[model samples]
Target: MSEPGTPRTQRLRHEAETAAARFPALLAEAQIIAASVVHGTHGRRRPGSGETFWEYRHYRREDAASAIDWRRSARGDQLFVRETEWEAANAVHLWRDGGAGMALASPGRPLKRDRAAVCLMALASLLSRGGERIAALGETGRARAGRTGLERTLHALAEGPGSTRAIEAPELPRHARVVLASDFLDPPETTAARLSALTAAGAEGALLRIVDPAEEDFPFTGRTRFRDPGLGANLLFGRAETARDAYRGLWREHGAALGDVARKAGFTLITHRTDRPAASAVLSLYQAIAGLR
Candidate 1:
């Protein structure tokens, strides 16, 4: 390991501190987005029943006598029955790409990495609130639940795997859910192979594409300097606008391939732009995981 005060160590320390400082705001924004979605709906629609109190209603003829809330019933002439919401608190593994490619964005847009982070945190907030467990992929062997789990997940994500690297499929419980946020610019076959492994392990989840608007539009004209942020490779274009049609075509093909892979793996894939509202993506994630739509 490098010395404690060395440049590498100092950089690591600085990143940790920065993550710590940003945690509150990041989590707060997550909570806000989660809350909005929660209020707009009844709750998550997952398998299995839960003990958490959902609501209280007047006892009906079809209701079992044992289901009656006796304590509350005694206060009124009418009998009441306690109802519980369906909380299939399954383990949800989250992973966000932090690669250099994800760091790219348009002049007025947030970095793809930042947007991915927000979506991850917001989803965590929703899952935590719904009494589900969460784990960052490749971080822990087992998933965690509640507030502590959320904190642990955030920390792991901040210091976890490199973005440019291939995804390291974690050993997860059977039937566990996963949520992955990335631009997914990787080779389709590579991504497919990894996802296929997870599916074979009985894991199911959603894939989110965090993209920049400029990536789709290709608004650059005249001469342009195109560089690979991760590889540090540079390419100069005399007429970048001339390549727009081909680039957009390739982008579509990439998306189609990803969709096919997701379909085979029994997962859902949704794309969101940095310029769009984060809540939209969060809602889509919630629905996909909940198997709603």
Candidate 2:
């Protein structure tokens, strides 16, 4: 009943389950941190307040006595609860790059891209459990929810050999937030411009740069054969120390340039190494985006 290579799907399911087990604690931490930030508080308004509270304000213009914070009034004269409308639940789109470069296996692992997909699925599950609609976008876009939807997304991500087309700007609602997961081995300007377009369209986005440790450090030494998995090509290179300094410098510069692009576009950028625990990276990223830590 299952096709060959479908085991990847099963692996994704297992990873998602493991991630879900840890999500409750992580989310709790995220909430506590988010509470300290203004945007976080605004994003987590009470759902029932829409009908009951007609407004919020600085305790001005004949405000109702019941609505006033008497304790705050004792401390300051300018306390008010202005009328604020309840915001509707928003959706999150998780876009993953399944291109060949992303498929490069970690030195000792089967495939780094597979692991990244699992992480993305776990994150999507966490957000979905928090009442946000979750959608998966890759070569094609699939929108679903709940456990079943998450499974479907994982399966789709695992099946894709790689993306052949260029990254295109997604059309999302003005208030939508996007979580883009990719190694981003593509042209810097092209990727940066695409992300910028998302921000320009009134949607906020976060970039997750999943990288293999080797890519970061160029740890290969002596006579080594470097192969391009996506292109099916191999090349021999000399000792790592020969160009290690220049390579590291360029790598650091690349990261710096990406950071600049993200800041300029008003998006958050997080880089994660495949060798580390994905949960740690995810938690750090959530805190950064939520302005908690």
Candidate 3:
């Protein structure tokens, strides 16, 4: 029998409640940041004559008879034709690291997961405003757009799969854009393989590496205990300062390797610390996605 409140299901439910409570603020902040950077411009990539509704225009002599909307034309004295919206709806697949490692953050800083969610949602808001389809990778159902899309993306993020392991390649369309936000602490080769597979499948995207200030700074000195979140393995350092140099070196090399892999795979990588303003990262991510179109 499982404990009343400590069972995995109960813990997950509690987490969902916590995230739901924070969802509004996250959404609002993302909207504000997206607005500030994107302004009202979305830079759509779709052609002028797509299949979505645009407007009704008076029929032109050059227009084909089949182009006329007979029902609309009958209601008005003048012949009228229906035109599709000029905006294109490009597909953008978004994913965030859901590992136990992402749960680590210093006391006064947001969790890496929170920061990643903000960037993902904010970028989605900006992209939706520009008429793009937004899909949360690994979630069921199709990509969405506008307010509905944002809502779906938020719900999925707050309540979906919980794991830190690299995400499997989800099926996407040719030339779609994918945005992955994560702590990216996984092994370099694992990260590289996932990226290469996505590229080979024809989806171009940006990677946002969310780092906690503590992890980046390694401010702890003297005896300190470090535990791997997923493995439950602990390492005790008598003088943590002694390990600081090597730690920093390894971190730098890890970052460089991620960058090299991303470049080789033809994807863009952006690093954002949880303590910094999220707007900068959001804006940069938006520009990168826009550039792909």
Candidate 4:
């Protein structure tokens, strides 16, 4: 193991401090987005049901000693209170593409990855407010509910997007919900197969397609040079505008395929441009998720 003040240790410490500093601000934004989606209702879509979903919150002094979740509390310095969901909420698995492509953005625009994170975080907070359980797709163990679930999702997001190319198709419970945000620039067949597997498992969800303005409007002209962000390859176009039609044609084909897949799987398709308001995407995504049976 490295010593306490070693460079590696210091880097890790700095990373932790950065995440710590970001948590509050991130959560606040998420909550604000969540609230904006369904003002004064905590994003609740329906009446409460009797089902129980184990979730966590900070322990309060007024709570009984027996209410403390000793095992979870042991994981950190703070006490925790385990709670049961009193709403008609269910599980919602979440995933976001974390590839270098997602890091792409036009000038003065937020990265696709960043926009995806905001949408995911806002959706998680909205669901948590209504008592829905959430877990990273393909993660081990049960889905977490309430505030802790949102916390866990935030941490997962801060860890960076996992594999950018191939998405996992882990088994989900029947009627379970999923919410995935990505550029979905992969081969249409790959996305189709993943969705097929999940649909076959009796799961339903929404696909929030995050896009960049530059991508949507291939506005390059004379003597333009294009670089592949992932492969680091470069292509020089004498007149990039001449190729715009072909590029857009391919883009349309890809989008059409995705729409077909979502339609076949009975999932909702949501498209958001990074240049647009994140609130609109957040609201649409939450509504789509909430409507999932």
Give the number of the best model, judged by TM-score. 3
Residues 1-293 of candidate 4: C-alpha lDDT, one tens digit per residue: 99999999999999889767765665666667777776733445445554475467677554579978899999989998766654213778788787888889899987787778777888887777776777766542246776677777776764554553223545454467888888988897888888887777667889999999889789999999888888999999999999999999999988999999889889899999999888899888877776665
Residue 41 accuracy (lDDT) in model 3: 53
lDDT of all the models against the reference? 0.78, 0.60, 0.78, 0.76
- Model 4: residues with Cα > 4 Å off, grouped in runs: 1-26, 40-89, 164-167
* lDDT of residue 164 for candidate 1: 32
How far off is residue 63 in model 1, in Å?
41
| Model 2 local distance difference test score | 0.60
lDDT per residue for candidate 3 within 1-293, as digits (tens), equals 56667778798888778867888877777778777778645667464446877567677564578979999989869998776543222678888778889889899988888788878888887787777878788773446667887788876665555343325655655566889988888888988888877887677889999999888789999999999998999999999999888999999999999999888888899999988899899988988888887
Question: Model 2, residue 146: displacement in angstroms?
Answer: 3.7
- Model 2 Cα displacement at 84 (Å)? 16
Report the Cα lDDT for residue 61, model 2. 40
| Predicted structure 3: lDDT | 0.78
**Colliding pairs, model 3:** 46-88, 99-164
Per-model C-alpha RMSD: 11.7, 13.0, 9.7, 7.8
lDDT for position 293 in model 1: 23
Evaluated at residue 180, the lDDT of candidate 4 is 81
lDDT of 1 by residue, 1-293 (tens): 89989999999999889867876766677778888888754544356555777667677564568979999999979998775543223678888887779889899988788788888888887877777778787664346677788888876665456333334555655567888899989888988987877777667899999889999999999999999997899999999999999999999999999999989888899999999899999989988887732
Per-residue error for 16 in candidate 1, Å, reads 3.9
- Displacement of the residue 32 alpha carbon in candidate 4, Å: 2.7
